[model samples]
Target: MDSLYLLLPVSVLLVLALIGVFAWAVNAGQFDDLDREGWRVLEGGEEAPTATKAQQAGVPLDPGQL
Candidate 1:
């Protein structure tokens, strides 16, 4: 059918566009820092749980206090 001719070219163009975008991203170092990005999702070792100012000063929690 005539619609097949139009759809074929459109699909090919879309695939080409996606490939071009992927190539551009690769050339721009968008995928270079894989390890750094991966580790960011894990718990960071540097940050430790600490008490707030009120807790540090031995303040009692009121029922309304956040």
Candidate 2:
């Protein structure tokens, strides 16, 4: 019973803190354009990774290249 007094307040405070953080994130544009980054990776741009470049160039790739 005594533990409930401490735990309940702590849990409530923790939930409130989490809600505050989420609200702040929404106001700060953190959630904006969430899909743009996902699309960017799928849509492969001009800049390629080293492994991809070596494959394109037909050069053997070392472990570092990967």
Q: Could you report the Cα RMSD, in angstroms, for every candidate shown?
A: 4.3, 4.4
lDDT of each: 0.92, 0.90
12-39 in candidate 1: lDDT tens per residue? 9999999999999999999988799668
Best model number under lDDT: 1
Backbone clash tally (model 2): 0
Candidate 2 differs from the real structure by a C-alpha RMSD in angstroms, to one decimal, of 4.4
Q: Which regions of candidate 1 deviate over 4 angstroms?
A: 43-66
Tens digits of per-residue lDDT for model 2, 1-66: 999999999999999999999999999999988999999889997866565665888988788855
Least lDDT summed over 10 consecutive residues: which range in candidate 2?
Answer: 47-56
Which model scores highest in TM-score? 2
lDDT of 1: 0.92
